[model samples]
Target chain A: MRIRSTLTFVVAAVAALGIVTPAAHADSTPTVRELLDKCDNGTDSCVFHPSSRTEFGGARHQVGRNANNCSTVNQNESIAWSDTTGGSNSIGITITAEYKFGEEFSVAVSATYEHTWTWSHTVTRTDTLTTPPWSVGQIFHAPQMQRVTGTYELHFGKKFYGHYYWYVNNFSATGPEDTDDAVTFFTRAMTGDERNRCPKSVSTAKEFVSTESTPAQPALVASVRPGD
Target chain B: MRRTVATLIALVAGLAICTPATASAAPATHCTLRLETGVVTCGARLAAVTNNDVIIGRVFDDQNYGGSSFTITGSHPCKNGNGRDFGVQLAKYGWANRISSLQAWGNCWLNLYSGPNYNGDHDGEFKADTPYVGPLMDKRTQSIGFD
Candidate 1:
């Protein structure tokens, strides 16, 4: 007589079956935080530290602007623009959305780039900050975004799951350098669920997932994890 | 006959005190599986899993992660081919491993590298406890090297 069988397997998600009350919408367009760590209801809800933010303000919905110089000298020094003596810097970028029941998605950052001397008598100029408009690479210029954050869900014998990342900073004048350009984008999660109904829409593949390379670079970005 | 030899020794000591004693029923633990890179031989799906050595599978990593391979199997601690070749050299360049609270299937993760960027993630389960619903995430990456 050996009849012992127990199965309490609950890998439930779909946003945990209902409840995605993101009411407020006076219209700003850019509040997408479809997480998936362990809470699925239908469109893929199980992304724990899911996040979203598109601030750098652009002075009000412009989402575009630039100026940079994290100037720290001696990467082997060279700074010679006619004996230096000019300064100017400013920074502020915001588009916050807190809700995983509240918030801790920290990022109120500021910026500063210095070297403002628009000159007038004859002509004197300088502009050393290459091209990059507050990039995560301009988030692919908004291809409907299923990214720009991290973590996603859905896997096992059918396919799909994921882990994307960010800690982008450029267009800098100050405040956005935990250090070195940050990048990572592992993936799979995108199965079902939709915050309540039509929260944009993007179901990660339900699968038999396997990984090993594809721009999945991340050790510590966004908040810092290298040497400090 | 001495009361029938004491009733045949009290019926042989009550049939040896109603014999019944045995123990040893625990053995079925294997892991280090790889999917997308290939392999899902759970035929009848292991009869719909309660625990058939835990081999749930899936594969599709290729948006810069191309085709790779992996394996680790049973009581995994280490040296099962050196922990399955160090999880195939951390999925051969990208890396992945974030399995949590999985007494059964509430949280799960494993990807060597699929594309763009990766690592540090957990809680996106599958295989029978199925909750994701239907499919959608396959944008096309393919990064084994040489862009």
Candidate 2:
């Protein structure tokens, strides 16, 4: 009966052209906590930057002010800073989030950093008449040497879900006329007991798959004849 | 002259009975271990502990652990070489899973991990009086060092 109505109109036109193929809706990819919640919801596809600083004697010592906000996603959050003139600073901050899924498959990275600072300077001298022999205005109070440094870096590029780079560096120094408090509140309570023996957080996740799929190209008009 | 005062009274009676029996037989040179409650304490220094507790040596303080578990032998009680350095603070101060348990005395050797910096996930290498049970470090230990 007309070859059963032409094989039911050629299988309903190849099932309506595989239901309007567009690579079958591009297989909907995007996971890794939804691209780390779209880079922690800052949107615009994710990329953040933060900076801070405070100085003394050379001026520009605001000491504080650097809100810092990202709210966590692929995880990396915690920022802090404290200062008290001539020297006495405590800073511990770490923010890291790196993700690369597909395109070449898996890649997830994280790094954390923390630092404490203390610097002091104070000096006043004069009592010259051949080594403390006589006084022409004798003043003494000396203890000077202060230095503090901090740095954090994050760099992720090229389709691990696209580009990103972040860097933060903090600094402070004192000497020559000295200061006395270069880290002491009992040495910041012994660096808070060595930051309580480190390792607060560092995250990771991974996955990679591609085990062959390209064997359906041998059917290009392989055997069909009807009235021509 | 009366035999030199009888040889100085037998060398001051053998130095006062060998100096309090060697200072009551060794007291603290460093020791603080808490491998999940298998407690151990010894300090001639370092005692101010509370937050989970773990600090081995090299000038110590912050010590807490009075009982709930204790046993590490290789000669029952004698420390030196900075008592094999050790320290722990699994949570608070930024939180993270916290599980711990470990024991190693004498020649001392320990280096276990799960994270907290020694580059996590190694979980091995213990010596002498061994004993490291599961949760394989529950809460996932951050870092533990000794040699």
The model with the greatest DockQ is 1
TM-score of decoy 1 = 0.18
Kindly list the interface RMSD, in angstroms, of each predicted candidate in the order they appear.
15.1, 35.0
TM-score of 2: 0.17
- Give per-residue lDDT, candidate 1, residue A137: 15
List where candidate 2 sits over 4 angstroms from the true fold.
A1-136, A143-228, B1-31, B34-37, B40-45, B48-110, B115-120, B123-140, B143-147
Candidate 1: where are CA atoms >4 Å away? A1-8, A11-97, A101-149, A153-175, A179-228, B1-105, B108-147
lDDT of 2 by residue, A115-152 (tens): 22223223222222111100011112223332323222
State the DockQ of every prediction.
Answer: 0.03, 0.00
Model 1: per-residue Cα lDDT over A1-228, one tens digit each: 001112212232221111222355323211233322222322222222221212231111111222211111101111112211111121132322322211111211110111111111111223232211111211011111111221122222111222111111111221122212222122121122211121222111112122433312232112121122
Kindly list the per-residue Cα lDDT of model 2 for residues B29-114, writing each as its tens digit: 32333333434454443223332222221111111111112122221111223342333332211113422333342223555567
TM-score of chain A of each: 0.16, 0.18
